[model samples]
Target chain A: MKCGLVAADGAVLHRETRPTPRVVVDARGGGRAVLEALLETVVELGQKAAADGHRVRAVGVVVPGIINAESGIVSAENLAWAGTPVLAELKAAIGDQHVILAHDVRAGGYAELRQGALIGTTNSLFLPLGTGIAAAMVVDGSLVSGDGYAGELGHTRFVNGEAAELCACGQWGCLETVASAAALARRYGVRSGRVVDGAREVLELLAQGDPDAEAVWKEALAALVDALVMYTTLVAPTRIAIGGGLVGAGETLLAPLREGVAARLTFQRKPEIVAAVLGEEAGCLGAALMAWDSITDESGEQTV
Target chain B: MKCGLVAADGAVLHRETRPTPRVVVDARGGGRAVLEALLETVVELGQKAAADGHRVRAVGVVVPGIINAESGIVSAENLAWAGTPVLAELKAAIGDQHVILAHDVRAGGYAELRQGALIGTTNSLFLPLGTGIAAAMVVDGSLVSGDGYAGELGHTRFVNGEAAELCACGQWGCLETVASAAALARRYGVRSGRVVDGAREVLELLAQGDPDAEAVWKEALAALVDALVMYTTLVAPTRIAIGGGLVGAGETLLAPLREGVAARLTFQRKPEIVAAVLGEEAGCLGAALMAWDSITDESGEQTV
Candidate 1:
């Protein structure tokens, strides 16, 4: 878990990381342990902020799951949580400070939009090529939440026919099936008959011109390009920020995407493809930003 | 062209239709003639409203084109317009009245959201399968404009592999290439080796169980299913209203789409597919609604 204390001026006061407890789904109240851990972390972080002579005004928690806006419940597969009253529990844990819950990717995109790579873009996307892929879409100057169900671009189909693979999401040929960081590493191992150290070693082998690495990399790129083209054609974004682990490949990943999308488009608006600047800190920073925005909003003050 | 005079209370005062002037693209001033005709139509419509003892409060014009919000320039292929100062011309033609320009499909969607099939729904889609296909996306309680370049769902790839057809938009296997009304007629003719009158004739043939018509219809439905599934996966709309002339086929068109989309969806929110009401007049009504919204917005009054 990545946690941080951010000042009102968008400066990081303190940062820390802690190991997340593995969810034992089969045991009774297994999800409770995860929830308890989250509350403990938030309380400790608040205490640390006081020790550092800083007053915590609000707390923003971001999760990779579906958040029901009205019910304040969350359903996350990784967390082993189903319809958990996360918002109500958080409020009970920390009395009276404003608490904001948001999607991690959308919050990251908010950070990018406010102070990072997507600062000037209104219609844009923040697509992180992580272990599991998802998107944060900015349409007409506002982040689209779709009541916590929007921006599942990674789950959308990009691969078809016999070459397609089944995704962990129970769908076949999803963009995440071929283009996610985990997919790249897994596909590389299957194709080469040797396991490498994740997508990093796969990238390293690609730079050294290994045929299997090249093949898997090419497949990932093809699916990514198809996804990007489909997004551009449908939504007409002017900029797209690529983030997460695979973006560490830099020009190796971005150049082919730019070229492929350009070649496929006819009358559609072409988006500028660029790397995300904030890196892994984006989600943590975005949470702070959102929390600050909520307080500032209550005071009728504008947030940057 | 469908034009109408709508009272502030959402009653239709008058309505009329006129044939659009064909553009001679190779000839100089051909596009200018079309522009002049549009301007003339607006002036005459205002005059008609005046002669009927009702004042024209605003003029809302919707077009099938990319309208650059900053410059008020419009680029529509069918109209032979390239960066034409349409908003400026409309303003010049109608002296000082509020002249708001918008996309026709989006306007139609606004009408649907206000008074037709999509009322009481926030996140939804208004997709019309006309001669060509485009979508009017209602995301998070507002219609998405993307500065007039959004909602080209028809141009996105659906059919792939060797059977993919080249679309008029210069793409291969676009949803428009297989699912559009024009494509339905064209594909039926190609399969049967006999030209049908239109998509209506093809529908009639399908009713009689013609093999060629059935094949073409099946292809259209398959592509539509793919397109709807993709839309649902990404945008997460709760309802989808299908419009255009093909919708006259009613249950034949909607039943298979609903069943196919349901069968394919795994984790995505399944949208209720229903036929669009208001038929062809949707665009005109939406234009009026938008104009009223603009006016009501100025006075700090709620619209719908």
Candidate 2:
């Protein structure tokens, strides 16, 4: 877990990374271990912040899952958390601090919107091509929560016909199945009949003129272009910030998308495609920014 | 044009159909004729309402084109209106009344949301399969305008590969190219080598067991299913209200959509597919409702 103590003025005073416990699905109260780890991390971070002469007024916790806003429960496949009382657990761990629970991608997008590449955009998209693909859609200056059901752009189908593959989400031919970081590595292995380190090795192999790596990269690009075109046509975003692991490839990943979406569009407004600025710390920084915003909000004060 | 005056309590106080003046594109001040006709209609309607002991408060004007919120200009190709100052013109013609300009399809969706098929939905879609396809997206209990560029669902690409037909929107393989009412009639004529009257005739031929009608109908259904499934996966609406002339087919259209959307959905929430209740007069009613709401707003009062 990457976390930090951020001042109200958006300065990071302290930072730390902690190992997340492996979620055991078969163990009794399997999700409890994950929750406990999160609670410990937050509590320890709060203590460290205080030790450094800081007063914590609010806390923001973001996770990758469907966050039920009203019930304050979460359900994540990887975390083995099925409607776990996460908000209640957080309140129990840190008494009386203003808490905000949000989706990781949306929070990251919020940080980008407030301070990073996507600043000043009213309608924009923040897409992270990580191990799993998800989107944070900003519509008319607000992040679309859809009650935590929105921004599953990665799960939408893009690959068509026989080339379509079944996704981990039980859907056929989802964008995540072909375009995500994990998919790039997995598809490279299946295409080349050899295991590579990850998307990093795949990128290196492409740079070295490997045919298998080229094919897999091309496939991911095609699906991603299709997804972007569809999103542009439907939602009409003026800017899109591409982030996560695959964005590490830099111009190699962005150029094709810009060109392909441009070629496909006719009446729709073209979006400025840019790389995300914050990298891995985006989500953590966003959480802190949100917590600070909450503190200001609780005091019923406005900030410039 | 079907027009109506609706009471604040959702009652139809008055209704009528008026002949629209044919736009003269080559004449001096070409689009002005149509604008004049609309002005005359609104003025006459207001006079009639006052004659019947009703007080005029606000005016709502909706059209089938982009409504530029900032400039209050409209540019509809079919209407031969190119950046016409519509809102300003309306205010000049009907002085001192609060004027609202909206998209016609969006107005229909608003009516459906208020008192029709989507009465209680917070997140829903009002899709009309007419001569062209467009969507009125109700996300988080509010209609999403996307600055008038949004809700062109018809224009989104659906047909894949070599068989993709070019849509009038300049995009190839759009949902409207195959799934719209005009598409059904056009495709039917092309298939049977006999020009049919319209989609109504195509429906009749289907009932009579014509192979050509069955083939075209199946093709339309397939593309529509693709569009709906894609929308459901991306937006997560709780219900979908299908409107326009095509909904006249009733069960023949809705049952298949419900079944197909249900079958295609995996992790996404399944939206209830139902026929739109308000029919052709929905836009007019919605305009009045919005006008009434605006009056409430101007008076600083709340309405149920």
Candidate 3:
């Protein structure tokens, strides 16, 4: 987990990384252990801030899941959380303080909208090609929450016919099956009949002009292009910020996407494809900003 | 055209239809004639309202193209309008209390949301498969305008590779190429080599167990299913209200779509697919409602 003390002026005073505790028994569910680690991180950070003569105003926590902002319940498949009352626990741990619960990708998008590549755009998309894929949609100057269920662009089908593969979400031909970082590593290994470390090794192979890497890269590019074109046709975003692990390839990934989407768009307005600026620290920074905005005070009094 | 004066309580106080004047010269744009006819209609309607001792507070016009809400410019290919100053022209004709310009399909969706199938649902879709296909998206209890460019689901590519055909929007394999009412008639004609009158004849042929009609219908159903599933995965709408001429076939059209979408969706929320209730008058009613909403009052003065 990436945690940080971000000031009002968007300055990072201090930052740290911590391990997420794994659930010992799958039968009992892994959510509690994860929640406990989160709580510990927040408490320790507050203590550190006080010692350093800083008064913490609010707490913002970003999780990779659907956030029921009203109920403060979160459900994430990777984290093994099912309707976990994370907001209630956070409130209990730090009484009477404003706590903001948000989707991790959306928080990252907020950071980008405020201070990164997507700044000044009302209609845009923030997509991260990580181990999995999801999107943060900005429509008419507001991030579309879709009642905590919108912006699953990766899950939309791109691959067709027999070439299609099943996704973790139990859907076939999802964009994540081809364009994501994990898919890159998996496809490269399958095509070459040899296992590599991860997408990093695949990127290195691509740099060396490996045929198998090129084939998988081309396939990923086609699917990404299809996804972007479809998204542009339906939502009409003015810009799209590409982030997450796969963006480490920089121009290698973005260049082809820009070209393919450009060639495919007919009557639609062209969206500027760019790399995300905040990188890995975006979610943490966005969380701090949201928490601060949720309540207007440094007095530790709850307004909402 | 179906024109109406709707009360704030959603009552149709006065309604009428008029012949649409066609443009004369091939060199001259048809937009000028269309705009003149529209201006005449609004002016005459206001005069009629005053003679009836009713006050005209707002004027709402719904058109079949991109309505630039900020600039009040309209650009519709079918209407031969490109960046036409429709709102300014309308305000000049009728001294505006409030003048609203909106897309016809979206206005129909607004009427549905206000008084029809989508009344209670916040997250929903109003899709009409007429001569063309378009969608009106309801997300977070508000209609998504996407700055007049969103909800072009018909233009999104569904058919890929060799099976793709060119769309009027200059794209290939758009859902509208196969799933729209006009497409159904066209495909049936192409498949059987017999020119059918319209989608109505195709539906009749389908009821009579024509093989070619069945094939085209199945193709349309397949594409529509893909489009709906894609929409459900991305936007997470709770209900989908299907409108337009194709809905006339009733259960024969709706049941297949519901089944196909149900079978294809994996982890996504299943939207209830139902036929729209407002019929052809929806656009006119929606325009009136929008005009009423744009301002605060009706002072009971019967001013023309």
Predicted structure with the largest TM-score when compared to the true one: 1
**Which regions of candidate 2 fall more than 4 Å away from where they truly are?**
A295-304, B24-30, B297-304
lDDT (tens digit, per residue) of candidate 1 on A184-277: 9999999999998898999999999999999999999998999999999989899999999999999999999999999999999999999999
Which candidate leads the pack in lDDT? 1
lDDT of each: 0.89, 0.86, 0.88
> Considering lDDT, where higher is better, how would the candidates rank from best to worst?
1, 3, 2
Candidate 2's docking class is medium
TM-score of each: 0.97, 0.95, 0.96
Off by over 4 Å in 1: A297-304, B297-304
TM-score of chain A of 1: 0.96
- CA-based DockQ, model 1: 0.88
In model 1, the Cα lDDT at residue B56 comes to: 74
Error of 3 at A72 (Å): 1.7
lDDT of 3 by residue, A1-304 (tens): 9998877767788899999877554655577888889998888898888878788877889998778888999888778888789999999988876689998988889989988989999999999899989998888888878777888899999998899999988989899999989999999999999999989899999999999999999999999999999999898999999999989999999999999999999878899999999899888888887776666654532111
Model 2: how far residue B282 lies from native, Å: 1.5
Task: Please give the DockQ score of every candidate, comma-separated.
Answer: 0.88, 0.73, 0.81
Off by over 4 Å in 3: A23-25, A297-304, B23-26, B298-304
Candidate 2 structure quality by residue, lDDT tens digits, A84-160: 98999999998987788888998999999999989999889999999999998888778888888888989888887
The residue-by-residue lDDT of candidate 3 on B1-304, one tens digit each, is: 6787777777888899987667553636588988999999989988888788787877789998888888999888877788899999998988745778899999999999999989999889999999999999988878888889999999999898888889999999999999999999999998899999999999999999999999999999999999999999889999999999999999999999999999988767789999999999889888987777776765433222
